[model samples]
Target: MLLLSACGGSSGNAGGSGGSSDDVLSLALENTLPGWDWRKQISAGHVGLEWRPVYDTLLRTRTDGTVVPNAAEKYSYNEDKTVLTLKMRAGMKFTDGAPVDARAAKFSLEGFRDGGGADSLRLAGVKVHVVDDLTLTLTLPAPNPALISYLGGSCGQLVSPASLDSPTLATKPIGSGPYVLNTRATVTGSKFVFNRNPDYWNPDDFPYDKVEFLVMADETAQLNALSTGQIDGAEISLGSIERAKSTGLRVDSFPNVWSGLFFLDRAGTKIPALGDVRVRKAINMVFDRSAIAEGIWNGNGVANSQTYGPISPAFQKDLVDHYPYDIKAAQRLMKEAGYADGFSITLPEVDHYNDEYSAIAVQQLAKLNIRAEVVSVPRQESISRILGGEFPMFVYKMPVNPEAEQVSNVLGPKGAFNPYHSEDPELNKLLAKWTVADGDQAAKVYQEINRFLVEKAWFAPFGNPDLPWAFNGSTTISGTLGTTPPLYAFK
Candidate 1:
């Protein structure tokens, strides 16, 4: 991929497009954004650009794990959590100066549902109804347990009703966000320059007068820009933390993603050894999760070997030690399962995680007589190999979403990644309980389901890697501080 030449003057020690003022904040992202269309933008690279500055969600999630209203000033739901009613703030307007009212609210929410995007799954069976200028109601065919959380996410964001029909809005967005795109100053697909939205309802929230987003596919390039002052901030990997802080950049880190092996052939469809539960347990018992998390991930990840991160709402500390590294015990189990000499399996080559983790697993599993073969292929081809069920094990990073409906699709019966597309009657029942239940009720149900996965050895979760973010200086952007810029507060 070709990179755009940096605009403005020398990479000075200041900020802004030309390094002239702090009002203009420039940041670097690891990948180029797909586009400005929220319904179509699924990558995390474009989240911050969409969530806080370019668009506004009906609800917003804070760093402290609270979900509150943003564009929708207040909201309510029925007892079963089926019907949702949203009451908008008195005076919000799109960048085009169009009033953001109930009709526009319905249009935006329904737009996402029918947009054929990744998020449409969240809005399944959702129907939007406009009640009045400031009120809109969302009806669901059944209880949507994760409705509030989704409403607080990218899928629930509202675009400008004025520009909803414009084909250009896909490449160029117009929302009631804190910033407005300055097309003349932007080099589409490379860098986007946004001036503070003067007509924005919440202009006082984002302190910066200007903001610039640069798309650099190279991590080293992002850090280089951060070092030379070409950009004020860059989201980097754990490998770059010490190097970045050494250069006097402020590093802000958090837990963002979980990594692990998905045993796709649990029923022994492709790998007969996996049909036996002992084989799977033996695999889990073979990992020194702590060492791998500390050494390979560089202390940037937690050692909890479960799909759910320690910070996740569904996490149960008692289950954190579900798997212990005991090579002798693992070997014994393998022998009992008739794989004493070990078995070989193919894993897709995922450059980011698979290559390194699989290499480490090979060295460890060798003690148990397990032979591992990792094949390198294009990213999509590797994904197809797993989705097509041509492989036994898959290595990748997946979000530990607390939503039962969402989590179930990946780990439940008919789960996309479940080994052999397996199903546990009791576990499925618990997942059903979790979906309709919240708070302590839901947590209890999820606890049972999580424990079952561990006891059954359904997954070998490697835990969430700590994410690192380094910024040159601080501005008034206050709220969640990770990759996704949810809500901002002006100084």
Candidate 2:
């Protein structure tokens, strides 16, 4: 899951040709580029939008969430599925003229694994070997079924080996991608400019000759830019849907993220109530998901209890209402858990997200006799604070990735969202089985995992919220499996 942050910046008319020009594509991003280091890159949310055009991954994920070949022509796994060998496409070179060969792939992969990035754990206990100039193999300690899919995301983005040790690597990017960063025209926090790579290996993939990202942290500014023909498209809040449509802009909405409260301290190291399954289930049943979704999201989201979206293989329609809104039942559970008097807990909030969710949570949880305190934290420090185990539970949003990736992010023993490192023996067993399972067996295991999480009340997921994007009709933008559409997906 990407820890989103908000920062104020001025939106300018830099490279804003609107959607009238077919050669240039302009869009507004909620956040500026965090950095250019692909190793520390996040492949969801607005951050992914900033660096996607400048780096090419070994594999690619289609709009339908299928993994396919990109820089690598083909890939195969060993009989035991512990080793993955990739064959690189011939003649591909980075913008700096370094050959994008097996050695470069090895360096990039190893660097990412040891870089301590957010997604580094995906490659933990993995070793890379260069077989030749065009062939490389990744040896894994155990079979990871999601490894291929991860390669299509940030974890697989390849950087030039020549620039690996460059001091300016964080601020500047050097890769074999569709576009090159126009450093002269880019204003660090305001706007970013990219020009087509003349020597790009796959020129036909990207139709636009130039791509520009204007930093518009405020949604109102993004809407104004879209209405004034200053930008082609922008990811907007659900509340702006009607306003955007009234202005004659095309609105594209899809389920991309699930937002709700994360019960991080299941072990109850700080709050003993969270350790009891009954207390967690009682908390889950107290909130009306339908009311929250319609009232807060303006009827733009679906009310579901599971973290997996409709498209995920693990998504079970029957689990949508696993815990219905029943105040009496919740109180009964709370009383049964010997917490009839309730307990106090603090929830951290960020400015970028709507405060209404947490406010409603506090109100609903109060009915169940739980005193929830909402604490506002700085956007920059919110993620660190949560991961540091400062809060037992908190309201947040996260992208709905594939089943395997979702498990690795939220349910795994070392999951990013599992800040307290809470462990369940049964969940650990299912996760181990999922790593080596394939085909029908894999789907079954995934569903079992989802059922286990929901039944155990590990989280109180409100629903899968629609990610809305407003744009002009000059060019078409396709929906992606991420918060924002990729630049190459626009035509």
What overall lDDT goes with each candidate model? 0.68, 0.81
User: Which 10-residue window of candidate 2 scores lowest in summed lDDT?
Assistant: 1-10
In model 1, residue pairs whose N, Cα or C atoms come closer than 3 Å (at least 3 residues apart or on different chains), thus clashing, are 205-490, 300-466, 342-369
Question: What TM-score fits each model?
Answer: 0.82, 0.92
Q: Give all candidate RMSDs, comma-separated.
A: 6.9, 5.4
- Model 2 alpha-carbon drift over 4 Å, by segment: 1-19, 352-354, 377-388
* Local accuracy of candidate 1 as per-residue lDDT tens digits, 1-491: 11121112212132345323566677775445557777754423234444357777787655444566777878888777778888888888887778888888888887877876544656767899888899988998766565776676666677877666888976678777767778888896688787777776555556567777787757788878777778877666777789998988888766756777777777787778888899889888888888878887898888876777776666788777888989889889998988898778776775433466777777777887878877786532443356557777767766565345346446654443452567667776776677677678877777677778778987787777876677766532343323344435222
- Which stretch of 10 consecutive residues in model 1 shows the poorest summed lDDT? 1-10
Model 2 steric clash pairs:
none
lDDT for position 16 in model 2: 31
Candidate 1: residue 124 Cα off by (Å):
1.0
Per-residue alpha-carbon lDDT of candidate 2 for residues 42-106, written as tens digits (9 for 90 to 100): 66567777788888989876666566778988888888889999999999999889999999999
Overlapping backbone residue pairs in candidate 1 total: 3
